[model samples]
Target: MTANDTDTDVLIAGGGLAGATLALALARMVPQLRVTVAETFPLASNAEPSSYQPSYDARSTALAWGSKMIYDQLGLWPALAQHAAPIHHIHVSDRGHFGAARLHAAEYRQDALGYVVDNRWMGLCLVRELLKTQVQWLAPAEVTDMTCHGDNVRVTVTTAGETRELSARCLVVADGGRSDLRERLGFQVRHQPYGQNALIANVTTADSHQFSAYERFTDSGPMALLPHGSPTRASHQSALVWTLSDSELKEVLAMPDADKCTRLQKRFGWRLGRFTRIGECNHYPLALTLVDNPVRPGVALVGNAAHSLHPVAGQGFNLALRGLMTLVEQFRLAGEQGSNPGELAVLQRYQQLHRSDRVQTAGFSDSLIQIFGSPLAPLTAARNAGLMGLDLLPAAKRWFAGNAMGLGGRKARIQRPGFDNSKALNHD
Candidate 1:
């Protein structure tokens, strides 16, 4: 296969959430550009029984209000709204301390602070929307090698039993945190391990959650419980993210279900009533992985591939969505100007536009983990005071809430326009 074999303007590697969403966004925003997504996992129908994707597994994500806007623009909210649980309030407190802060949706005049959607459901919605677009899908396929040229990128992909070279003006890598493609390209990254693991599970409580979320800073780490499922569901449940040390996590995972629930209740207290039952639990090592530069000639990285942050604030996915919006905007402009999407200038503009948001969001989450995890008496006291001050100060509370809701900073909206084929031109 050569550049003339396939007419893909933008070829995306890794058809997980980010890649799939990007394909869909580009299709909607720049419909004239042909996009192809090559994924390592088989198509849903062709997937083997043992195939399990961590990013799209049993875990759940809290979608901030800003994320909701993106979904609304994509016309996907209606499909996902059914399975999502709205977060009407957020309660932040320090365990065994007097300092606490509460943020209510009513205060911001919004229906909910955020929403909790299971990844499985979210993936289904995205794939369904993707199938309706013109983007070509390649699954059970992996990119073996890639070479960048002045005007295009040549990607060698292995699918089924053959290797083929596909060409595109630009390539978007969303292969995730441990990205082989990124490593092959020699992109430098900064990684910091927190020596913590997040144990996630869905739990049913004796009382209703009323769509409120809780973030409790404990001696071990921060534990968060976000309401899950709709109010009409038969059982009241919430998603639990418990951070524990490596040793503590091993011991907890080895415990029997009954024992695990008991220990969890002891640590979490009676905030949401007794823990009746918990579903299967999964663990993820916590770390901060940041790419020094997320863009290269004819290439761009999104989601975990570019920056993977600790899940303390649940801003990882939300931040990625914002970045995607920015990338789409840049692509749309390039298309109109009939410029090469792979040009260094176009990629640099995206980097400059998104740098501040990435830095601020990553720093905010990292700071929370460090400050709350500190055992020093003075630092603990100061953190406690900070929490109380946030609660008492309306302006400060609003500022904090805005960032948490993903509404702070420059806003990017998806541009919906009729496809203009005349504006789309070949790179070389």
Candidate 2:
């Protein structure tokens, strides 16, 4: 076959976290398989990660223990540890509420509850690890079209001022929630808009965060304070992901630094001390988006392409990682059974492995947004009551905590109480 007709075992489109992670997982799990990743952005060091970083978003992700396990298996966590902040506790409260329920890593006998990782740092670390994998990385490339043939799928990519054709037994979409490839493949997405925006920024706390994550719910939405690496020597830093009303968002964005810090100080309370300083603030529209299905013929979707949930709980990446790990396992099983890992049967297996988790997590997140985001008096009271009830039940509390940590269900293996190893690979 000519170069244009040459085929790879698998072709992955959209090289963000999901795509990159999937490629690495497949390379490690499926031996001798040729994999190609087509990414739009030129692979660059984290020194400059897209226009998104210009604001120093100071944003961080709360990675569940499960996500950590996958990273460990991929040998990515060791490299990422330098920039990670472990959360030893989580305090959940409500605005105008008298009491708050707290979850402690000590209760679980784990080293930490979860980890707070800067997106830039983790993304760069993943890219660095990706460079070491056997998977081919195609930069500044775009997938123009894809067609499923009798035994293979043909993918056309536009890159470097030329059109190139590549065939693979299977095609994987690792794009974001709004996957262009998913649309090209005729997958339908269901969208649920919260009609709200989440404002994110890094701030300094007068009091040491002591590596705790705080989730305080208000009538508007949830305000999440995620621990970050130490602040400047003079300041104690933490990442804030706060949801706000439209007017509130506009007001906050327009506020002078001093006024904004004062407002934040009033709401966040003295637990972390006054908000002396705030980093560049950014806002993201909140939504609950999911796909009807994640697989089609030789095509499979991983990460955000499969599901994007409300970030209030911060399990988006953890869920994506779980799906990636399952896909890897399914591919390995397909190979051992003498079946093409990119074939319809293999894709179906991965779908089955993910179907429950996808539906449950998506449903859970949507319900949470609806319940907590609403201003109805009854709903607010009920939600808070439920939270209080959960606090009273040790088993239920552990289950909820496990879910947040991405360690829920039979496939999950919880590590140390405060530590997450869900992203790590279990050799045995």
Top candidate on lDDT is 1
Cα lDDT of all candidates, in order? 0.83, 0.77
TM-score of 1: 0.91
Q: How displaced is residue 224 in candidate 1, in Å?
A: 0.7
List, residue by residue over 1-428, the lDDT tens digit for candidate 1. 33344468899999988888888889988898889999998778723222333231267889998888788878888877877788988999889899998998877667788899878777888887888888898988997778975578888999998999888888899999889999998889899999999999988889888898999999999999898877344336888999999999999999998888898998888988898887889889999999979898889988999999888688899889888888888898998898777778898888898888888889889999999999899989999999999999977887788778875544422111453322431111
Measured on C-alpha atoms, candidate 2 has an lDDT of 0.77
Cα error, candidate 2, residue 408 (Å): 2.4
> Worst 10-residue stretch by lDDT in candidate 1?
419-428
Measured on C-alpha atoms, candidate 1 has an lDDT of 0.83
TM-score of each: 0.91, 0.90
In model 2, the Cα lDDT at residue 263 comes to 86
- Positional deviation of 176 in candidate 2, in angstroms? 0.6
